[model samples]
Target: MKTRWIWVLLMTASAAQAEEPLGCVEVTVGGYKAPNYDCLSQQMGNNPEGAAAAQKNMEAMNVPVHKRPPNQLGLATPAATSTRMGNTFGTSVKPQRPPN
Candidate 1:
């Protein structure tokens, strides 16, 4: 009975494994495993359409990084000195301290 149970469990496990979806198929050409099914198929020339599709997908996933200018910051300039103290706030109204 124990042996039969073990066999049944093994069969169920195998079935489950077979039913599970696979992400990619790996192939080694020059001692390096191909990253994904598309890549492997591309290298092997098994499916040109599949390879092109995979390449397109990868390119879509990649985003170009915009480079900043050499001098990122803008140059600073000195402000004009106020001829009159009351004109400092850009208003003709006499400058007065707010109620404390």
Candidate 2:
């Protein structure tokens, strides 16, 4: 009986979390997007059609960081090489942050 109750409680909690929608937007789950239009536009410059779709998604996401440039382009080549050799977020990579 105790085990059953525990399972029921866990299930209920999970259900609540799943059902309870959350977001900075006033829509459903993951409904918000980034606020930066130019950032998305810049990123789109590199990706083409895909960038447009991504921009829409980001806009819908409404996240602060997402609003910023994603810099899809590689950062530091050296850093990437170093990472390949080991496990670190070093400066070996040429471009770390998104394109300015």
Clashes of 2: 21
Per-residue alpha-carbon lDDT of model 1 for 1-100, expressed as tens digits? 9999999999999999877344456679999876676645545665559778999999876645444333333422223223333344455446534459
Candidate 2 off by > 4 Å: 22-100
Q: Please state the error at residue 70 of candidate 2 in Å.
A: 40
lDDT of 2 by residue, 1-100 (tens): 9999999999999999776233233234587644555545555465667868988999877757645454434444655566554643553444244446
What's the number of clashes in each of the models?
Answer: 0, 21
lDDT for predicted candidate 1 compared with the true structure: 0.60
TM-score of candidate 1 versus the correct structure, residues matched by position:
0.24
Instruction: Point out where model 1 deviates above 4 Å.
Output: 25-31, 36-100
